[model samples]
Target: MGGRGRAYTIVALCLALLAAGVVAGVEWARRWEGSVTLLGNWTGGDEDRFRREVLEPFEREHRIRVVYQGSSAESQVLAADVEAGTPPDVVVMPGPGELAAYAGQGRLEPLDGLFDPDHYDPMWAPEVAGAVHWVPVKADLKSMVWHPGALPEAEVARIARDPGEWCLALESGATSGWPGTDWVEDVLLQQAGWETYQKWATGRLPWTDGAVRKAWTTWGALVGAGDRQRVQRALLANYADPWGGSDPACVKERLEHQASFVRSGAHWMAVRGRYAHAKAVIPGARRDATAWEVAGDLAAMLRDTPGARALIRHLADPGTAQLGFTANRAVPTATYDADPMTGRVDATLRARGTMRCWDASDAMPPAMRDAFHQAALRFLAAPDELPQRLAVLEEMRARHRDAAWLPTVCGNG
Candidate 1:
């Protein structure tokens, strides 16, 4: 009784322990199957909107859990992760420039057959070394002038003539001067046409050239850049702030030059904002041609795991309509009809996709891009310093020779 009973009891206990271990391992495996990591620059309200409108639905439908990390320094974080061999499964970068560099280095996974490439404008999912590596998940039109309410076309032109009438907000954390860069880039695009804009943006044209020089001068005159008090305030003010300022000057700033997303700002929302084609407002835009500038957040696979592939497919769907503006033509036009402003922007994006160009600095390498931002800040502070600034920018661009620039920044002419 003692030997037989004791042996049977020990076997039963060992079997129980083994069963418990197997069950625990199976549970862990199930949890791991539904989880993926994503890195992006979307933070605060942008992050919330993405989760609410896009991510939450995907998670529910597919039963996958997304671990997202949003930060302003996402590129640096991404680089460190790659170096440490712990990169996120997916990443949504702010532009194609950074993605191009990553794809060229074999750090990114190709996105072939994940989604229909025909759904997007060719530029949004430009080829990377003969294979598509990234696609834009969100897009914003950069060439627009916003007024509190719908202003008559004639009135918009008149308001644009006066620098005092425009609202200038230069503050953007570490990227304070980017507003000016956008202005100059738009001016260049319209005045020089897409041919020259492309050449200049990709570093093929010298920064000291006449077309480039004229763009800076045009922006300075349009914004009254040298006016001391105004410059001081503009430099200090944050661009993200709502326009309903208590200051009489701010209240009187009836016009704002910003991206299409500015429609959601309190000032625009209160007044039922309207937009004018930026060309109409610019002082000396060419008579014959039209173009638009655009920017986007692009998604790329880093790990090629099952979870990452599913996230990529969800992002690439034309039916995913949460983005404020999308370049995907397959997105139902009805997706934006409830908001007239969004409707107009959606149309403009498609009509101009063949002509729309990337924000020049956004297409440049980071070193050149940051230098461009700082140069813009300097130009805003002192219009007379333009010559020196352009020279410095050219020098910096030369230094980044190894930087893999996005092959094409604009749609086919």
Candidate 2:
């Protein structure tokens, strides 16, 4: 209880206080490091799988906390957030056109020097000026025809001639009629080829062009003007439900033309499905030609930060890109062993050069894209109104001609 004892006690107290401050500072830094916001259109099982497989691993490795916002109306949500001056650090949108619009408006951060450029196809990460704006995280192969199993050439031909033997769905709630767009786009790609398809998609070619007109008529002959009862069912049915349900009565003998996601879905498993490229089934399809329609979920940084950049880097890694069931072969990530259908799709997507093409509607300006969908529905309801539909689409294209349209949606190599 002398002067020396009091001095020693004061020194120990000072040391303890310093240690506590240090600990608090470290804790605060840790909390700050572990936070990022991501916006995407993956909900339900897709969202859950992503969180478990991709985000959780990234979080564990880097100690970053991801704030994920998954919505069916992701574009609307993102627009609201951007307008409010509070966009997420990163966003994974399906449409490159929408992402391009955001990039043009300076809402996106340049993803320069974050990941290897060679890992992705040029079409997946189109450059703005000299900077890449986004990277594909997931891709779906469109222009595929799904059947219960492999059928003979004769059976295939017979089914192609009968509209009643086809499964068609148009209703998608707010996005109603996009399924029909896929049909016409695939038909165009198969009937005319990528050159003409790309030109029309980007507004370089008018909708009234002979090739475009033929594409529409070809689709009309196939489905749009086909059977009345089947068309009615297609008009009322939800697009996803056809691929997700096991209604034999509705789907029997009916081959479905849908994206590759159908093979990875639970309903496809229940039905024991199989698929062939659309070109193989389309009547009078060019014997020497091959083309594929594709769609992808692209990741772009909106608010650049260390955490956001890290997340982007992870997504850009070819190894990480395969976390989801992507049809992209450029990303050599994990493969689904049990799902052979996805394996076939992955191989088809990986095929080189102009054989692969992005979904034309997805690559078009938003207004034109929506118009395309509505036009599809209209054309289906009244096949005789093809001229009118073509005229209307031409008007929409003219209105948005000056807007940003991708110069290319396919790679030469």
Top candidate, metric TM-score: 1
167 Cα displacement, candidate 2 (Å): 0.3
On the 0 to 100 scale, the lDDT of residue 49 in model 1 is: 89
Tell me how far the alpha carbon of residue 21 in candidate 1 is from the true structure, in angstroms, after superposition. 22
TM-score of every prediction relative to native: 0.88, 0.87
Which segments of candidate 1 are over 4 A away from where they belong? 1-32, 242-249, 352-354
Against the reference, the lDDT scores of all candidates come to 0.84, 0.80
> What RMSD does model 1 have?
6.5
lDDT string, candidate 1, 74-115, tens digits: 878998999999999999987787787788788899999998
Give candidate 1's error at residue 409 in angstroms.
1.2
Which regions of candidate 2 are displaced past 4 Å?
A: 1-32, 224-227, 243-249, 321-323, 327-340
Clash count (model 1, backbone only): 0
